[model samples]
Target: MPTYQCFDDLQLFFKENNIHPNIRFENMNENSIFSMVKHNLGISIIPEMIIPKGLESIKVIPLELEQTRTIGLAIRTPISPAVKKFTEIAENWCRFDKNIV
Candidate 1:
């Protein structure tokens, strides 16, 4: 099994499996984390959004597990008609991007 630095479920799995990786206590926002991984300083678990470009040296193997995050829209009370229209437009935009109705 490949190692990871920051997946919550994967960390639990590691504990269950009694396999400990060289976990560095670093957050993903720091560029050093990517640098370290690229330099083979250590392997890390990063979100897909932050993966760097031209990383042929690094391999991004996909996992079988399915994961998703929920996104929400919020507005202040007494939403105006314009705001409602804008919200509809935004939803349409997102639906178009996803090719969904």
Candidate 2:
């Protein structure tokens, strides 16, 4: 997993669950992770929306789990119309899905 702040909790969860990979690659960015997966350097669990261009051949497997991520929508005061619409949609979707936000 990437060495992102979001992965901190995930790492702890993995340790508690005794889920360890043979060769783990941490301290990498999302782009590097995607490149590694594309070139068969390693495998990653990424969202479909973030997949880079020209990696259509890669296989996709959706895992169903009861995991939740605390998400936030940061917007400055006096938000634009578009941002307000997006925020509303996002919050509604987050409320609907238990594993997100």
Candidate 3:
């Protein structure tokens, strides 16, 4: 499992539901988590996008709860032209269709 903000959120979720899981690992990246799970080290809650296909040993189970993840772009000062354009495009895309959930 990760030792990030999402880890905290997952902990809160488990606590709220009274699910005392046996978490045997921590501070691992998504790929590391996948590897561990594939080797039967433990199960994990990872983002759907990061999951690779064609892994017969692993199962992709969708979470039943309604959840949303907010993503943002972080750039240092004195950004380049390409990065500025990309950010503009991303912002526009995010604002395009607010009603489509």
Give the number of the best model, judged by lDDT: 3
**CA lDDT, every model vs. true structure:** 0.63, 0.69, 0.76
Model 3 CA RMSD to the hidden true structure, in angstroms: 4.1
TM-score of 3: 0.64
**Residue pair clashes in candidate 2:** none
Per-prediction TM-score: 0.48, 0.59, 0.64
Model 2 ranges with Cα > 4 A deviation: 46-49, 52-55, 74-86, 92-101
Q: Candidate 1's C-alpha lDDT?
A: 0.63
Stretches of candidate 1 exceeding 4 Å from the true structure: 1-22, 77-101
Please, what are the lDDT tens digits per residue for candidate 1 over residues 20-85? 777656554547666666787876655554566777877876545543434568989799999899
Quote the lDDT for 10 in model 3.
83
| Candidate 2 or 1, higher TM-score | 2
Ranking by lDDT: 3, 2, 1
Per-residue lDDT of 22 in model 2: 61
Give the lDDT of residue 28 in candidate 3: 56
| Clash pairs, model 3 backbone | none
